[model samples]
Target: MENKKEKKQSKGRRKIEINKISKKSSLNVTFSKRRQGLFNKAGEFCVLSGAEMAIITISPGGKTFTFGHPSADAILNRHLTGNSTSGESSTNLVKGFWWDEQSIESLDLEELNQYVESMEVLRKLVALKVDEMEKGSDQSPSDFLAMDSNSLLDAFASSEAENIE
Candidate 1:
């Protein structure tokens, strides 16, 4: 056989350990790239399925990142307001509210009233938190908890109107 020089194979991607990255700069770069990839996949799903989608992720440094087909708020409001009484109980509870599966058909008037009142309280608390965030106020969660329900509802309504416009 004729002697021939063999060329070395180029190195490709290698398996990396799943340990925490030691380098801060590398970690940040990786986070940014991965976050972009996640958003791209969500957008692709939305486009291919004609379905609305939203993603909310908090970075390791506590900064929030969000991506939505139309908007995060719009998607959230749609999900919240969508009819949930289609003969199926949701296994997952809403982010800020909890309800059990005591059939509404079985509840008496007093129980129904109590349920409605509890829901109103939860709604006010959520609205207050949303209002503070919209106003860019530096108030803590405790401060929001201390606010009156009526004022919170008013703030929340104004914010809702602004969002609609």
Candidate 2:
């Protein structure tokens, strides 16, 4: 009798479509890995050039992460002060900035915007659940609960905002 062993074939890397990933679990996994890779590259660049670097990423799951070589705050502050040059002194232009003025890159502002969007989605879901409870919706509680966060959000995004409010 002869014994034969077959080797498992592995598919090498291939190009992927750049469209939005629809699967929630897969999307989250890909987002996290890519974000980590980006941060790692930035760190490498900083180490090689002795340059300051910062990266901020917002995930679809409402997670916020930051990477900095030196520190993210120091890099951001230098940029804001218009003194990114190696030998220049930075003036405090932010001192006189008004509250109404906006800096989208501000982590607080970015985080706040993300929080608001998440809350809006939650509110819509709650309103829908209440309405369905009263009307005896075709969708069962189990079915609704089984949906991933992204699916739940997508379903209610087009709902009547006034009614929900």
Candidate 3:
């Protein structure tokens, strides 16, 4: 029995062809080691090339590994798209060159436009709700009012109450 066990241990140490294993436990262990090795390689590549990248993977044991670019998601998204309209987006394509031409004025304009669009949509929704209310519908004006009034600060307290429950 000891001789057989020693032979099996020696075989296990030898590199085996990658395939689905019948033994569930062994397969899981192999997957975890390979996944860690892959992440380490990615980190090395990032360090050497000075490039932005994101590699996300879940190990066989259900552990997650994530590698991010210096700017992280913002730069990764631009590379995936293959085209960029702004300087911020273009920086990902050219390594080590970091300059964002997206000015505060443009950012402010975008924010204002988004706010206006959101407000317009909300107004339309409220008008529809008001029409529904007028027709003796189940939905109340208070519901619409609450949705508009809810803010981030209020959301935090509401979430705390939910967790307590």
- lDDT per residue for candidate 3 within 63-113, as digits (tens), equals 455556454467567777874544763555565432243343565776767
- Residues 1-165 of candidate 2 have per-residue lDDT tens digits of 558777788878888778998999999879867986998899899889987777878879675677766656667777888875733212223333443365556659657776566567678678878798779765545345434567775665654354357
What pairs collide in candidate 2?
none
- On residues 108-156, what C-alpha lDDT tens digit does candidate 1 reach at each position? 9988886776576658768757887788886545345434557866765
Task: List runs of model 2 lying over 4 Å from the truth.
Answer: 1-14, 86-165
* Each candidate's clash count: 0, 0, 0
Global fold similarity of model 1 (TM-score): 0.42
Against the hidden reference, what TM-scores do the models get?
Answer: 0.42, 0.43, 0.38
Assess candidate 2 and give its TM-score to the true structure.
0.43
Q: Give residue 18's lDDT in candidate 1 (0 to 100).
A: 95
